[model samples]
Target: MVNITKDTEKEELIAQFWPQISRAAAGYENRPALSDELAQEMALSVWRSLEGFNDQCSLSTYIYRVIHNTAIDHIRRHSKISEDELDEAMLCESPTPEKNTLQAQRQKQLIVAVNQLPLSLRQVMLLKLEDLNNIEMSEVLGISEANVGVRLHRAKEQLSKLLAGMN
Candidate 1:
């Protein structure tokens, strides 16, 4: 297994995976400020953990596992936030120049649904969204492949229900 030994390698990994990391962070937090804060925390965590990253899994899986774990911890620590504080913390997602209003609105609805999913389901769904196969997701999450499939199936069902309700 190749060991991570250089700052440049670390920088390259971060640059390459930043979009996935950003989306995962934003998808986890659902609030712009918190998402940015969460993403920064993820970057720092990934930077520190670089030396320990064994090449057993793909870099994508490893980085995602770190980000997901960090996001979970952040959520746990902030669990005591009040309803009003949560409302105050909420922010709309930023608009992408290429996406029109209808597209943006649909995307927003999807994001909201994703954020509302239980973490296990969300993790599997997010990883799947990034095009990881069942094996990679299972390895990254330390769950059985069967479990990943079950969770994904349930998550998709839930998401469909959620979108249906929104319509």
Candidate 2:
């Protein structure tokens, strides 16, 4: 009975947050294989961290914090994910026996452009994409709401320039 209760709690935890965690990892790494690895790592971390979770923040915000921190750690260990690498990642996903869909191509371009951004800008964009409000993003990134707004604005400008150049 004790084991069953613990297992059910862990399952609930994983089910509740896995999509957000996976999406964040995908945006952060921009590489399917790496993102998959990161998502698994994040899930494990969440399971471990749940043992001592406090109610200081909403669970969603806390999960975002963990995902963001994991992303930073991944970036530190393997700094500078390059444009060529992004291109290669895209190429690897190209359709076989069928032409590439326009939507897929645009998504690939957007991902590449995003990956080219500086860390601050990238972090802002990623959090914003996840539909997090500025306040929640501030909590995740440990910055002021004003600063998040500034970074997000700058990141949008840079992304426009990058996409324009790419196209």
Candidate 3:
């Protein structure tokens, strides 16, 4: 059927997109271990949706959209736990002193705080921290430059509050 041919073509396109997808994903360190899985999912989504792409945007832009959305989806799905629960779980685990338990606790707090942010604000923060410039971020998030600024501002404020409470 036509679907089979299209699926095969999509698989080939995913192969082409893999390297850049992984590179783009590298800058997200909050959950570094999920990078490979997230990148592959993004690449496959872009490939499957390629036929419907209107060419209104650059291929890079389209790919970025796919990756950004996938990352946001991952974050939202994993953000359900309360900070208290996270802290309790971490405390229960026994880590070596060389592992710097305090530093690990702080990092966990940071991630939990980020998770508490609204999805739009969280996405902006993550993309910005990943070092994507305004234009690149706009392309990736499918948002206006001005909106990205607003979201980043709100996200920073929320993160500061969360961090302050964590100490």
What tens-digit string does per-residue lDDT give for candidate 1 at 1-167?
Answer: 87887999999988888898898888778556778999999998898888998887887788888888898898887653444554555444344674556887788778778877888898998888889899989988899999999999999999999999989
Model 2 C-alpha lDDT per residue in residues 50-113, reported as the tens digit of each score:
6555777777787788878888888888756676887787778748533366776677677778
Candidate 3's TM-score? 0.60
- Candidates' RMSD to native: 2.6, 3.5, 6.1
Q: What is the lDDT of residue 66 in candidate 2?
A: 80
What TM-score does candidate 1 reach?
A: 0.87
Per-model CA lDDT versus the true structure = 0.83, 0.82, 0.69
List the pairs of residues colliding in candidate 3.
none
- Reference-based lDDT, residue 51, model 2: 59
Return the top candidate by lDDT.
1
Could you give me the TM-score of model 2 versus the true structure? 0.87
Inter-residue clash pairs, candidate 2: none
* Candidate 1 clash pair list: none
lDDT of 3 by residue, 1-167 (tens): 02323777777767776766775554332344565776766776787667766766666567678877776676566644465665665577567774476777676676667767887887777666556777877888878999888888899999999899978
